[model samples]
Target: MHPRLIAPGALAAASVLLAIPASAASVSPGAPGIGDPYYPAYGNGGYDVSHYDLRLKYQPATDALEGTATILARTTQDLSRFDLDFLLDVDEVRVNGARAAFAASGEHELEITPRTPLAQGTAVTVVVRYHGIPSSKQAYGFTSWHRTPDGGVGANEPEAAWWWFPGNDHPRDKATFDVSVQVPDGTQALSNGTLQSTVSRLGWTRYSWRSDKPQATYLATLAVGRFDLTTGTTESGIPVVNAYSKDLGAQAGAARASIERTGEIADWLSGYFGPYPFNALGGYVPNTTTGYALETQTRPYYSPRQFANGSNTSVVVHELAHQWYGDLVSVAGWKDIWINEGFARYAQWLWSEHEGEGTAQELADYAYASRPADDPFWTVRPGDPGPENQFHIAVYDRGALALQALRNEIGDDAFFTVLKGWPQRYAHGNATVADFRGYAEEVSGASLGTLFDTWLFQPSKPTASAARTVSLVPAEAAPARPRSWQRIAATNGVHEH
Candidate 1:
């Protein structure tokens, strides 16, 4: 089940003063799970995070990372204790600057019990000191954190932020971040947002980064390595700071050339999607450690292989577009992933159309006609695809196809309105599929239930008529279709003329 926002009345009812006599002094613990069906044990209830200040040091030789995380949050209900999704050996825990008892339990829950029961609407501060090898569990066929040859990359997507620091590790809870990491002198530590300052001392350096914009936990990143740093500004004046691995050697030149276009792409996307969402624009730690590139808030992480040739601008466009679709307006849960992947994929198609390669209509037609009726891609619904299929091709390809179908149903004006209005309305917050559908209907002034049902929910392939072109033809002039056997045989070995 999707987690619903807590009601004010319900929250008040949970408070100790309301539920029990004042003299009794009884308090209830916060719920461990936030009610997400896919990952029930992901986030905690009874509190909302406002900001996270993480200070850490890393040693590549021994693979050891020690950190102190200070989280400022507001209590939603009276609580004896609360939980944070943490997966490290904690040395000490403090609440509101006072010593608090804590224990690590069950997967990633760090159960912290304050010395005094916290009152509802009170502000609380939690500080945790922990140390160990930073590691991530495998989920959706990829590890969130990878150990690079020189250092390591933290790419906590889905529910892996706990591997590095404790927090309410879910997309629903977005918070600003101040992450500072100290590493070896020669190496550079990169993270989201603007580089506040860099200080060197005693063979070590500390790099401080500040992301004032509210960000989800999954989009938080920390990469440490020896990098060739490039700093500039986009045509629109957004700051651009990209870091390339020195290990690329000769390939570093081509990588830098491709990265230099970060400004150009941001300018183009801004024209279509309204103003850029964040204060910074750049890619970070481009290396081959991770097979795929991830939109890590202000600074995305790219794999060297993705941009090996100068011709791989589509992947760059895809990740940069995610800054608006995924990072700015995040999903409510894992089920709404298509809102992110679909928009990014559609941006690729739009870039292709803008470059005169092929129109989005042509791409949608090709994808619709290429897949067989029984293909699993069609069977798995993109809106609620399970955890295993969260990142499936259907999420990217079929999801884009659905958006194109909606665009064809509504004209370009209304479609463009949605593209710009979506992130603008829900910037720095979480949105669900229902929320999107209602917003689209409001903007387009059309009931899109049938179109959404056919494209997003139906298991079978939709008819070509679903994606009607802007210029319509007479019913009698419709194109004829091939027989089912012909399509099946073509999918198999035989092809019939």
Candidate 2:
């Protein structure tokens, strides 16, 4: 899941008092669009993000920074102009190494047009640079942190990225990213992908990380603080590295155990689905005020504040599941969010099955029976409802229930076949509910129109009874042994054959 946009439950409370900021006020450090943010210049087949290479030099001494980005993008069709979402403080813009005209600086997004029309599939290279002291209170395009006595602004929530480079702002447009940050000596910088390399420059250290896969813009993240690295491997042979604050104590045992469990979960899922889909795998536990975690490509950003006694260890599992479900097999749009969230939620339940906590069907039945039918979980449409609704339990839980329904109707073997085949068919691509239905029907050789129509298209739960019946083989009756959960368990005590 992406980090919360605001404090939990705060958005709803603030919604009633909502009024646009007087200007793009500095809501927090690194938030360039506080007053105004950049929007992307999209083409007909939707804004296509090709690649982003950001070069930034951070100077904590003066609390200032300078950076430039070389963004390469192409369109599905010819277009005269478009918009790009970048952080404020940009001083110049160039296209193909030539100075390009751009407007709306100090605003949230940048509007840029090439001197000549850009044809479909033609790549456009853009570059921009600027210098400024990022606010410590808010987060924006680029997050700047000063060496504080305790640490940097860990709790401060304006996610800074715009302050560092120019590109799309929203998660709707997914693309590859390469980030290079140069900071003063002794301080280490971390970003989303597997670390490509690190070198020390004159009085500064440059670190570069590359994600060779498509990623949501907001899911791109970086953490700069004194840090130490601990590395290990999963049972399935994937590299698992943990990055923690250098000043903090070492928890290698805990980290290794938790990460290895992620592999175990993935392996169990592979039996039902396919292999986990990503280049590398691991996490970075940065000190933060938030209690949530993020699925940032090969690695996820985890906040230590969120877990206690490892009881809530499933957060990492949930995010790890996202790599296969959400990151690799993405939803075509927000409306098809089930493909992203619902599958991941089921992955958690699948993990529970592996742990012997409960059977998959039992858990699904529990979630479905507990939640209301008219709940917003069923009402989610593809739109920017808000971050609060992004990982809504309803979406994850109820969505999982929908999958369980299919399993019940089709049976385990067929359902697992669809689960394993989905990522292989649409790896690194987008999918819709219709695509899922078609694929499932095609694979299972069964008609699922009614299943999809009632579960996905219908606004409310269907009134259909369980037409399929379940019977224990050989038809033997046993005396009720327990007092709860099942009515039969509380009644008779002897078995009759």
Candidate 3:
């Protein structure tokens, strides 16, 4: 399972071009919605997903998978039925270990209809078995395994988990994850949080990982190869494990330094935002050609090409920031993704401050000068990150700019106060931009309507107009860069509120 939040463009562009073996599973009980099918709106609050047991045999030679999955979930609402969305490749399913029906109405989702009424807080377990060549495409969620130029294997499944398993495949449905994968004898496997154990049976190795925190569907990850593994503990007792590829040479002290720094950052964030939400914190530096890193729960997956060298502190800070912003407090849906990227990006800026680097102003000024004035928060259209721009720039960079603006409007103490409070208030849950804005207004004791409107709602930067009329004292000289007598009008094509 490769769980990463995907941009809408990538999600919209997928099709069944690659060949997939057809399955003869029983006909589904009913049809599901054409749009993201897995995350159904359960009216009553508090969803409890108890456990997930996946039985799969993975063949790396041809990238084929034969597996059975049993999932148990509970809801606080008194409901007669429940439905789940999984990848379309599933061949058979049983609710509570009995033959149950399912339907594939969407590209990446299989609608699961249970046979019996599931009452409030009633535990449910689903068993599924099937076989197919899981798609390598990111569109339908489940991405099959692929090896890099080095022998190490890495996979990414953002917005789509259907390439591997079956479930409610959306970020909103927070659940505890339990995975068991059967791989070849020599290969090692790594995933989201911590490894429980590895049992050897015949030529297959079943690796188990369990996450105690509430995790979104897209944050699940899997890496497999002849990995060189090392284990250590942080100063605060969090486990630190490293998975290095054989072709990547020996692990160095710098890796440990970064991990220690990760612990420090986590402590700082915990005090500021909330406690470390998960049981473990670690990740592997996979050999890759891409520069972007995937923050997969406690163990974030970093690419060696980007993070191994000391030059990629921003990337490291960005992913580490996600542990609180994106992982602990998540976006309710795809449209509000800025809450994830924006907060994480600002966390990087705060780290820069802690490191005694350039002030937040210098960072914002540099970012503002680099991007064109026409576009602000990356969306020419809703769900479009930007016109040919990675969500990083629009979502992360400009999103950071928005927080800087808020910081300027509110004093430093109150600003930090809001930052530290949000993750705990919304942990294991979902939030919107409005939710944050309300929280900020409550903490800051000021109106942020004009600031949020100029920075967030509009795709244009605020123009800092010089104070036209300056009052100079006749006797005493004014301090250098004195405060402006009048507020400057920001006319960057946005009507000021």
Candidate 4:
């Protein structure tokens, strides 16, 4: 069972303080977990993180990692102690430059108690020092940190960020980051944002990276390996950086050729989705691992096999589109994952239509008719498909169908208004499913209760509408599978890294 929030004893202390005229209420401990319906233990409450300063050193020979994380945060409520979602052993913890007592509870909770009770709205600095081998345990069908041939990759999603560094490891609590990693000579380290500086001494090099924009923990990525790093700028002057592993010898040329078109794609997307949300743009092509690609903040991660298969352009467009949909405006909870996947899927259709491959209407109509009436894919609601089925086909295909249906109901003008304005309004923030419905209504000046009910909430296949075409052909003519792009979309392209 997912963990629930453990309420503090502060109410009783407040009552005592109110009864006694001369006494003040004592601060109490914060809640151990944030109250999320899907994964309740994902984030901690009573504090807001502003920035994370992480310094890490990895030894590939032993698979050992030593890290010191200094987190800057502010309290939201009166607190004597608080918890961070951490899954490894901690050697020491300091709160506001003072030694603090800590204990490990449950699977991923680092409970820390400070020497003095903290007041509400007070700023605090926490430093944690730990040394351990990062876990490669699979959570949502992908390992959090995987040890590659030469080095390791840190690609965490949902509940796996705790396996590497300690923080309020959830998407709702976004923060800036300053990450630095030390590796052996002749190797490279890559992370989010811009490369700040690099210093080498005694056969060891430390590469520093900084992200000025607010980012969620799931979007945080760290890749350590021998890479051929390349840098350039987009037409609009956005910085572009690409890193390809030396192991991808022959396929590296095709990967670089496809990566060069990133600027043109971003320029096209900016015309429809407002401005690009990040300071940098590019991706990394590492040796094959998860058989998928991930939109890790500014720089996405891809497998060399994707390029070799001739799906490079479509995959690049899908991941780069996520910079606006998933990375910029995140979701409030795991249940609202369609807000991310759906938008990226629709972006793929939009790119296809622009390239003269197929229109979104045609794709949506095909998907609606391809499935049999009794298929479970259409029965599951994309809005809340539970934890285990979060990345199912319903979330991608059905979610995109919902958006396309909206585009048909509301004219192209209002629909495009929503596409552009929604991201700008909630830039670098989190939104829920209800928030999206309300925004669409507000922008279109029409009520869409029935549309959302049929597409998002109902538990069966939708009735045939004008958007769905009727077909009487052999099943082989129009296979029930998703289109080429949709096939890649099934990988839930955000988490695997």
Candidate 5:
């Protein structure tokens, strides 16, 4: 997801408190959240989901969504009850083929008490029937369910599924998904992974898409509308599917121009982040008013505004690099967002080098000097920015700065090794910021504690001499350098995701 903001200096912060844990036996209720320090109520505990079989029907005309979600999971503890993060009005819930009592506990949680206690390590299947206008549902003051002209889209960062489907909504609970959305015959339903079937019957069409690899729930997406889908394969034979809403008007051309290069960009990114991690490669431009682009697993989501200026492969690179950093290896907690944003933004810098627009060193130096020492950009500690500042520009740019600093401190050989090997080591799993730093240190045999502290943890800008000493570039303030992150900041028209 795009950080979207140039955080102001007055963006107040006093402190930031920042996991998932299971319970023991005793037939107790599952914890309301999956133990994330930043969001205590984000995900549910006591069970790990393996897959989600979502059979949905969406009516764009009414902005109504009706669905039955079949969740297959394993109980982590003996449980008298469990919770699913959801918001829609549920008609009924069944656990293990028996009727289960359920109710809405909060804005986004559905508390379910099964007819029988679930035993630890036992496989369980939960079926939920629900109906609602997803766009009408809001939590935490916003809605990720976007009501488009012809259809609605379910896509956002940190939290998305609550408005569309129900499950353990946090990134820590990665699961494969089979999403079958039945829409009116004239419209198309698009989602993650390979298209299993496009079956039409009696004025209704069902689009079945499946993600073979485990994916974070937020990364699972939905788009139901009239679309111009471009399908093919990458240079390395990975399947690619690009979608542009027919209503995109002027931005359609630019969106296509950038999104069509998904295959080519994935090919380029594979060199640095190891082989392409997923079964498919592509993105979608859905004429959304959200004003941001999100790295939604195999197919990233792009706002029409992202291409409002022209074809921007830098944004494309930013999202595609996330195929490795964010989608493949998700953060252990929300506080570890740098593992996603910083790593992907750094990929944009690499693309600048590849395109001869600017070198990474030049961009890093430019980014460092673009902000004065007292700018809130420096105040946002990328390592553990509070929830409010999690998606600040500093998390993206300063996070990339931390990576470049690591590269310089550890030297090119070890840095590149760490870059290629980090995802492979934690592929399809959750990792933290400290985990990444440790991996870099393990590869470089260099104690980088102070360097990370200065760049990521410290709330003040490092001295200009550090830049000169590391990347051999004079850290002059605001030179007439090549187009750098200041340009990206201008182009990154994202909402408060």
Candidate 6:
């Protein structure tokens, strides 16, 4: 989740029967967390979700949402009780078609005890009925549910899913999604994947969106409003659908210009990171004050502020790069945010290079030379920047600096190999920082432990000049070249994220 706070974006199991023996069935409550170091209480255990069929009805006037989530999953261990990370008011819960006792626990856990214990490796279907005004609920001090001028939007990094639907909330439990949103007939609804149908009946229009690729719960978004929708195909034949709020007064033209480039940018990114990953491609701009843009699966969310000046494809590149670094190959833990933000922010530099505005090395040199050794910017470790600094500017810039240093150390051929090969190696899967280090080391055949430590792990600037050379300065002096890209990111972009 970029929490530029940009997004939340996520696994698979055997289909054949592999049930636990009767003697091994020791029913117990599933663990409350999936063991993420930064977000220990985030996702739950006991079950691995495969798909979520969310049928929802939303009212813009009341800002109320009523949904029935039909979840298909498998118990990873014998479980008498399981939890779906949620904050909505649950009306009823049924496990395997049997009514189950459910209750609210802690800040975001919807605790449920099925009528019968589930054996390990056994498939189960769960249905949850819930209704609430999402904006009215608050957990961990903030709400991701956003009430817009036209309708409602559920898009944020790290914690948006809690207020909308019930499920395994962390990126580790990836699942396919069928999000069908019903709104007033005149209004439009948008979500991830290809739109299957738009049926109007009884004064309401139901829009059905399906994501065949395994997606994290946070990447599942719901946008209901009056929108001017555009559909097209990229040069490579990838279907593209972009949405713009009908009421984006001053920002309309610029937002449209930037968002229309979704397919083009995705195509450009493919050259360095392989093919576009998802079946669908697009983005949306809702008139909201939320200062960040998020890579919400296929359709990334863009704040109007992102384009206040004009078309800003750099921010678009950052989020779309997430389609690879953050969306396709998710971070195993929130602490490993460098894999997401660093790589994505680096994409902006690459975009600058692609446009002939500036080469990546020039930007890297500028970043390395500009920041003082004593600045707090150097202290925020990119690899393990704790909960508070997960989205810190250092994680993005310094993280990219780390990559540039690696590219210099390993040479362009091997660096590009590691860059393009990483997403393929861990596609649709979760991985940690250690996993990335190993992959790069394997590809370049160089010891990366100290390099990574100095660049990402240490709380101080790098002392070794083993890679590319840069002239350090004490002042915030502009480098001899490439200051435009920095303005694009630092001026309006970094604050939002």
Q: How far off is residue 254 in model 3, in Å?
A: 7.9
Per-residue lDDT over 20-53 for candidate 2, one digit per residue giving the tens place of the 0 to 100 score: 3432231221222212112212211324677888
Query: Per-residue lDDT of 1-497 in model 3, one digit per residue for the tens?
Result: 98999887765655332332232122222223313322332111323455556666776666667777777776555443445555436678776676667775545555555675445555667787877665453443434344554332334434435556666656666778877788899877777677899999889899998887888766777666666777877667888776765665433344444544566667776766767777788767655544446667888766554434444455556677788887888876555667777777677666666676655655565555545556544343222243233243456666777787777778779988888888888988988778888999999989888777766666455554310111122213222321210101010101000
- Clashing residue pairs in candidate 6 are 1-7, 2-6, 3-6, 4-496, 4-497
Clashes of 1: 0
The Cα local distance difference test for each model comes to: 0.80, 0.60, 0.61, 0.81, 0.89, 0.88
Cα-based TM-score, every candidate: 0.88, 0.75, 0.76, 0.89, 0.93, 0.92
In terms of lDDT, which candidate is strongest?
5
10 residues in a row with least lDDT, candidate 5? 13-22
lDDT by residue for model 1 over 315-417, one digit each (tens)? 6678888899989999998899889988888887887777766667766666666687788878877888787777777877788888998888888899999
The candidate, 3 or 4, that scores higher on TM-score is 4
TM-score of model 2 (CA atoms): 0.75
User: Cα lDDT of model 5 overall?
Assistant: 0.89
| Candidate 6: regions farther than 4 A off | 1-25, 464-478, 490-497
Give the candidates in order of TM-score, highest first: 5, 6, 4, 1, 3, 2
CA shift of 153, model 5, Å: 0.3
Alpha-carbon lDDT of model 2: 0.60
RMSD of each: 9.2, 14.8, 13.5, 7.1, 12.3, 10.6
Q: How many Å off is the CA of 443 in candidate 4?
A: 1.2
> Quick one: ranking by lDDT, best first?
5, 6, 4, 1, 3, 2
TM for candidate 4 is: 0.89
lDDT of 1: 0.80
